[model samples]
Target: MARRAIDEGYKVRCLVRSSKKAAFLKEWGAELVPGNLRYPDTLAEALVGVTQVIDASTSRPTDSLSIKQVDWDGKVALIQAAKAAGVERFIFFSILDADKYPEVPLMEIKRCTELFLAESGLNYTILRLAGFMQGLIGQYGIPILESQPVWVTGNSSPIAYMDTQDIAKFAIRALSVPETQNQTFPVVGTRAWSAEEIINLCERLSGKDARVTRMPITLLRAVRGLMRFFQWGWNVADRLAFTEVLASGKELNASMDEVYTIFGLDPQQTTTLESYLQEYFSRIMKKLKELDYQKNKNKNKKEKPKKTPFKQSSKANSQ
Candidate 1:
């Protein structure tokens, strides 16, 4: 989103906890504003002359008081600051069903912030986004049993997945269009998917078998199992931590037909499941191929062991 805004020739000022980490954005000619949500003055200072605000901040797991700091108190501070500075429209990036998904502690913060925006009288346009496919790319660090499996709790709900790029495009549109004023857009793609279905698709694409183990929430003990959190790649904490909200219980099958009607262009691109897997998990496949080849080389060496010198000599003499 920062890249898109900067590309659109807007004098984009990005607020990051550390300006040093924003080298990529700065390279794209965006002005970096060093600020932390925990500090109201710093947040207020960052929005002094800013016209629009797009919040993509994450609450660190170690911050026990982050709910009050960033999600609730920090957002309130930003809203108040934006209003005081006479900012035009507050473009908030929020999560879907943030209020409902309290099991994930972070979303609860988003819920409170959403309420604060609506009541802030700042002509806020909140974009509640679904999960991002990009999160699965990095060292997934999944359990390496005989079959790599992701642990899931409860029903394999049909979750609506949206590309981060698409969401950014919508966000850029919101920046220029006046019709988007004071509207809350629940943004999603054309299709919905379940965890098991996604796994199946990946396995099929890779021509390999993937095992999925479904565990009920009741089975997880906070003290024993969840505390150490050995597995995070596809664990509950991982899903909750990476996602802005969970689409697990709800069948999020509704298309952004409404958004298309309003925007006049179908935001939905023709990215198939195959394309998604290739784009996201290509590295995994490459690594697996390397491992397989190495294993084959070792097996061949073992199967054709070096001929015993004495035994071969005796056999040749006998012959």
Candidate 2:
């Protein structure tokens, strides 16, 4: 987020839950303000004298409340507070299909937030981001199979994926000036791919055997349930679900023609799926090498058990 704002040439201020965690960002030139999204009063101090407010904190796996709490209630309070602070423009991160999939928690919450913003009468721009490309990195934890038959509910959606780096670059463009006011963009990549095609791409990039398999719609909930039993990464299935959306052969982006024209920003040039997956797999290999080395070292350093003075077997050995 700071990367995007800073690239916009905005003197960035970040409201963080912890100052220490933000140290790297502070060192990178972000001004740190302490606040929580849940508390609007705390935001007032940080937002004072600021002309624009961006609500960027969205969700994490550890969150106990639904996205509605984070995206609506928390966001609404902050919006109300920012308005009272006399702020003018509001920028928001949103999702594609927010109107279509109001059933999905993320989409449902984003719609609510959008409604609030519309009602708040604040000039705003909403970037309904393409499914974040960075999410692919998290899905790496999904168990790899030989000829890996990845299951999906829908395998025909034409996914328009976007790199976060590109999203950040574009966001910076929007923020550097005031071109994106009162506009909502459902942003995505220039191209779309099916889930099967995406899986094949990953296989080629990783040099791993895998295939995309379509799971019957009736079994999706059960599969999600079964996967939940194992302790694993939170984003694994979410990434797959997103991929499945595109694999269903449905196009996710509706505004690509005007995305650039509306924002008056050039389309971003950055890593593509091949480059992103290549680098991702390379990083995984590096981490696996480190783990293997550590495992070997521990295996070689087996310590002898300490002899107990009270144990008869140890006493006999000593004698």
Candidate 3:
């Protein structure tokens, strides 16, 4: 996102919790302000003199803070700060159909945040995303490439996962598009893909068979219930709740025609799941082959015997 903003001639300011971890942002010419969503006191300083705010922060399942603390409480604080700062534009990224699954903790929080942003009176653009293709790298791509077990539930929904780069294009373009103000849009890929379809694609591209592991939804519910007892497992339980929604056989997708028309994006230019996976497998396999060739070349050099030195010149003269 910072790259897109910078390329569009906008000065990018990133509110980060760690300056050391966000060093790359500085390299990209983004001014980094040390702040965390968990701390409201740091927000005012970060928001000062900032005309626009692009919030993509979310609490992970393994974070020390609970989802309510970061997503709800912290976001509320940030919105208030942005409003007080007289910010011109605010862009927020959320999950698709967040309002439909209030039973899911993450979805509920995201929906609440969307409402809060709308009523804040600040010009905002809410982008509801189906999923990210980057996530599939760990979930299916790497597992299949390494011949590891690819876990899938009894019934999983087909999700139209968009590339982060495409999502960023929409986000940055929203800053200048008048129609996007105070409006919500769903940004998805060209086509939706199911778990089985993704697994098959990865296997075909990588030339490796996947060890499929299917877990019944009933067992997943039981495990989620068990995890709810422990404080550390609460976030995991919440994530499992959303996973159950995906396994409910409901497709997670939306029509992108309106989005493309409003954002002035060509549907044909969007990346497809097949092309993305194909490029990934090709790059990875080429890298592996290069590494293997280098290893063998070094081994051959080590195994070759050294040539014996010739006799001294004095011995030849005496002869």
**Candidate No. with top lDDT:** 3
Better of 1 and 2 by lDDT: 2
Candidate 3 structure quality by residue, lDDT tens digits, 113-214: 999999999999999999999999999999988888999997989999989999999999999999999999999998889999999899899999999999
lDDT of 2 by residue, 117-161 (tens): 878888888888767677755443243423445655554665677
The candidate that achieves the highest TM-score relative to the unseen native structure: 3
lDDT computed for candidate 2 = 0.69
**What value does the lDDT take at residue 75 in candidate 1?**
76
RMSD of each: 6.0, 8.3, 4.1
Q: What's each prediction's TM-score?
A: 0.76, 0.75, 0.94
Give candidate 3's error at residue 113 in angstroms. Answer: 1.0
Sort the candidates on lDDT, descending order: 3, 2, 1
Look at candidate 1 and tell me the lDDT of residue 156.
57
Q: Which run of 10 residues does model 3 get worst, by summed lDDT? A: 306-315
Tell me the whole-model lDDT of each prediction, alpha carbons only.
Answer: 0.69, 0.69, 0.91
What order do you get sorting by TM-score, best first?
Answer: 3, 1, 2
Candidate 1 residue lDDT tens string, 203-229: 665566666576654444333246435
Clashing pairs in 3: none
